[model samples]
Target: MLAGKRILLIIGGGIAAFKTPELIRALRGAGAAVTPVLTRAGAEFVTPLTISSLAGEVAHGDLFDLTHEAEIGHIQLSRAADLVVVVPATADLMAKMAQGLANDLASTLLLATDKRVLIAPAMNVRMWEHAATQRNIATLKSDGVLFAGPTDGDMACGEFGPGRMVEPLEIKSAIEAALSDGPLKGRHILVTSGPTHEPIDPVRYIANRSSGAQGTALAEALRDLGARVSFITGPASVPPPAGVTVTRVETAREMQAAVQAALPADAAIFAAAVADWRVENAASKKMKKDGSGALPTLAFAENPDILAQVSQMTSGRPALVVGFAAETHDVQRHATEKRARKGCDWIVANDVSPETGIMGGSENAVTVIDDKGAEQWDRMSKADTARRLAARIAAALGAS
Candidate 1:
C-alpha cells in the first residue's frame, strides 16, 4: 500500500537505535524508499555505514557539507519525503524539535519539513516522565506531529515502566494508517479504557482486572480506519495507541471529567471497567495500622455514571454510543437490559467470570447487542474483535 512513497528516517540517540536496521527493512518491505539521517549522538549507538547499508542509500548528515548541500540540501531533504519519522526519538532531540531549535541536520529537517512528521520516543522512564519532556510532547502534538510507541515495558535502564519504543511492525502499521484513505476519515471518536482506581488512602485503592488491551486495540483499529480518536484512559496496563490523542486519569471522577472535555465526537465507546463506588472518606494520608485491635469503618459513595450521562445527552450526543457489559451470568440478557438502561446504541457483552480468564487475557468472545438484537461473534483475538467493531462502526456511520 505504501508503494512509491518516500520516508525520511531520522535516527536519534538511544539504546533503541540498534533497531533502526530492522525498521529500515520493514519500511522497505512495505515498498517505501527510506532516506536515513543520523545525528551526531545517534552515531554513537549505530554507525552511519551500517544505516546506509541497511537502507541501501547514503545516510545524510553534516549540516555544512558543501557538496552534499549542493546535491540535496536540508530543505529539499525535508520536502522530498511523504513522511519524516524519528526512531528512538531521544529526549534531547525531542526537546530541540519542540523548541524549533535546528542546530543540526536532523533538527533542521524536522523544523523545515512541511510533510507530516512521526516520532517513536525512546528514553529512560524518568526522562520520558519529566515535566519538561511532557510539555514538549504536548506542544509537539498540538503542532500536529504524529507519534508512535514509547509503549509500556522494561527500558534499557533496567526500570520497568512506559519508555520502550514500539516494534518496527507497529510503526509500519502507523505509517500505513497515516497515509491510507480509510472509511472513517474526518470523523472523531471517543474511547474510554482501563480500570479506575478509587483511592482509599495515599497508597491503597480499589481496582479491577481490566488490562486495557482490548480498549487500546480498539482505539488503534479506529485510527486505522481513519477516525480521529480521543482516548480517555485510566491507569491502564497497556499503552494508548500511537496516533490518537490520549487523556490519562486515575479515578472514575477524573475519567468522567476527561470524557466530558472530549465532546461532540462522532462516536463514543465506553470500554472502561469503571468503579461503581468510591470511598466517602478516603484518607488524605496512609491510614495507620495502630495495634489497638480496631478495624476502621469504610464508607462508600456512588461514582458518576459516564455511559448513561453521555448516552442520554440532550445535545451533542455522539451518533453512536457503545457500552461494554462484562457479566458473570446471563450475558446476553443482562447486556440487552444494559443497552436499554444506559440508552446506548450497542453493548458489547462478554463473560468475565474468573474461570473464563477474559478480564486480563488476550482473547475475547463477545456478543454485540443492539436494537436489532444480539449478534453472536466467534471467539477471537482482541485485536480481531476490535477490527470487526471498527468496520461495523464505519458501515453504520456511512449508512447514517
Candidate 2:
C-alpha cells in the first residue's frame, strides 16, 4: 500500500525506541523509502548506525550539521516526505510538540514540517496517564495530529498500563492508512461498530456476541481509502482504528444520538449489532438478588433503529446508506427484505449462526444486496472484505 511513498521517521527517547529498527524494516518491505531522524535521547536506546543500517540510509541527528544543512536545508528535509512518523514519541517529546518547542533537530523538523504528523506515543504508564500528558495529547489531537497507539500491555517499566508501543505490524498498518491515496479521500464516512449494550440495571446490561472485529476492520479500510471517518463504536472488544474520529457509546439510545450527531456524511455504514430492545424501568442502582421465591419480571421497550432512521432521513441524508443483516437461516432472503424495509441503498448479509462461527470470528462470507442485485462474495478475512466493500463504496459514490 505504501509503494513509492517517502516516510520521515522520527525516533524519540524511550525504551520502545529499540523497536524502530523493525518499524524501519516493515516500512521498507511495504516499499516506503524511510529517512531516520534519531533524537539525542533516542540514540541512548538505539545506535544511529543500527537505525541507518536498517533503513538502508544515513540517519540524520545533528540540528546544525553545516555540511548536511548546505546539502538539504531543514525546511526542505521536513517537507520532502509524504508523511512524518514519530515512533516511541516520548512524553517529553509530546510535550514539546504540544508546546511548539523546537530546541533540537527532531523537534525543529517536526515544527517546521507542513506535512501531516503521525505519532506513536511510548512512555511510562504514569507518564502516559498523567493529567499534563493527557492535556497535551488532547491539544495535539485538536491540532489534527494523527496517533496510532500506546496499547495497553506490559511496559518497559515494572508497572503496566496503556503506555506500551504497539507492535511493528500494527504500526505498518497505520503507516499504510496514513499514506494511502485512497479513492475516498476528502469524503466523510460514518461507520457504527460493535454490539450495543442495553442497560438492564446499573450493574448489568443486555448485549450481543459481536466482537466488533468486522466493523473495526471496515472502518480502517474506509480510512485507508482517505475517508474522514466518524467511527461511532459501542463497547467493542477490539480497539478502534487509528486515523479516524472515534466516538464510544454503550447503549442503543446513545449510539443513535451519536450517529445523528455525526451528520451530513457522504456515507453511513451501520455495522453494529444493536440490541432490538432495552429493559423498561431499568434499575437506577444494582437490584438485589433477594432470595424471593419468584424471579423479577422485566419489561422490554423497543430501541431506536439507527440504520432505519439514517436511511429514511428526509433532510441532509447521506448519499449512501448501508446496513448489515446477520441471519442464521435464509440469509439472502432476510437481507433482501431488510434492504427494502430499512430503505438503505445496500445491505451486507452474512450468516451468524453459532455453528457458522461468523459472529465473532475473523472471517466473513457475505452477499452485498443493492438495487441492481445480490453480489455473493466468497469467505475471506474481514480485512479483505472491508477493503473490497470500501472500494465498491468509493466507486459507487464516484459514479453517483
Candidate 3:
C-alpha cells in the first residue's frame, strides 16, 4: 500500500536501536524505500555499516560530504522523503529536535527537512516522564509532529514503566496508516482500552487479561487519518499514544465517567476489557484471613454500562457507537445479541477461551457484526487488525 513512498530514518543513540534492522525489513516489505541517517552519538549504539547494509544505501552523515552534496544534500535530504522517522528517539535527540538545534547531521537533516516527522521514543522511564521531556513532547505535538509509541514494559535498564520504543512492526503500521488516504480527517473519535482493575481491598481487585494493545493501536491508526481522538484508557501495560489526550482510569467506574465527559465524538470504539462486576462492599482495611479457615464471600455489583449509555445518549450523541463482545461460545449469536442489547451500531466479537489465548496475545480473530450481518475476518496480528479496522472506520465515516 506504500509503494513509491520514501522514508528517511534517523537512528538515535539508545538501546532500542537494536530493533532498527527489523524495522528496515518491515518498511521494505511494505514497499517503502528507506534512507538511513546516523547522528554522531547514534553511531555508538549501532554501526553505520549495519544501517547501510539493511537500507541498501550509503548512510548519510556529515554536514559537508562532497558526495552527499553532489546529489542529495542536506536540503534535498530533508525534502526528499514522504516521512521522517526517528527510531529510539533518545532524550538528547528529542531535546535537540524540539529546540531545532542542528549541531549534528541527523538534527541538521531534520531541521532542514519539511516532511511529516514521526518519532518513536525510547529511554529510561524516569527520563521519559521528566518535566523537561514532557514539556518537549508537548511542544512537538503543538508543532504538528507525529509520535508512535513509548510503550511501557520492563526496560533494558531493569526498571519497568513507560519509555520503551514501539516495536518495529508497530512503527511500520503507523507509517502505512499515515500514507493511506485521509478520508477520516476532521472526525472525532473515542477509544477505550486496557483492563480495568476494580479494587476489592487494599491489595486485591477484579481484573481482566487485556493488554490494551488493540485499542491503543486503533487510536494510533485513527490519529494517522487526521482524526482528533479522546483516548480514555484503563490501567494499561502500554503507555498512551503520543499526540492523543489520554484519560487514565483504574476501574470501570472511572473509565465510564471519562468516556461520558468526552462526548459528542464522531465515533466511539469500546475496546476496553472492562471488569463486569466490582466488589459491592470494598473493605477499608485489608481483610484478615479468619481462623475459620474459610474464604471471604465477595459480593459483586454491576458496573456502569459505558457502551450502552453512550449508544443510547440523547444529547450530543455520537454518530457511531462500536462495542466489543468477548465470547467463549456462540461467538456470532452472542455478538448479534450484544449489538441489539447494547444499542450499538456494531459489535466486534472474539473468542477468549484459554485455548484461543486471543485475550492477552498479540494476534486476534474478530467477527464484526452489524445490522447487515456478520463478517468473520481471518485471524491476524492485532496490529494488522488495527490497520484494517481503522481503514474500515475511515470508509464508514466518509460515507456518513
- Candidate 2, residues 276-313: lDDT per residue as tens digits? 99999898988787877677779999999889999998
Question: In candidate 1, which residue ranges exceed 4 Å CA deviation?
Answer: 64-72, 153-160, 185-188, 228-232, 235-248, 257-265, 284-293, 309-318, 328-343, 351-357, 361-381
Model 3: C-alpha RMSD to truth?
Answer: 6.1
Q: Which ten-residue region of model 3 has the weakest summed lDDT?
A: 238-247
Clashing pairs in 1: none
| lDDT on C-alpha atoms for all candidate structures | 0.90, 0.89, 0.85
Stretches of candidate 3 off by over 4 Å are 25-31, 53-58, 62-75, 95-113, 131-145, 152-154, 182-189, 208-249, 253-266, 276-286, 292-319, 325-392
lDDT, candidate 3, equals: 0.85
Indicate the worst ten consecutive residues by lDDT in candidate 2. 141-150
Q: By lDDT, is 2 or 3 better?
A: 2
Task: Sort all candidates by TM-score, best to worst.
Answer: 1, 2, 3
Clashes of 1: 0
Model 1: per-residue lDDT, tens digit, 21-87?
A: 9989998988899999999989999998999998989998799989878866999999999889999
TM-score of each: 0.83, 0.78, 0.66
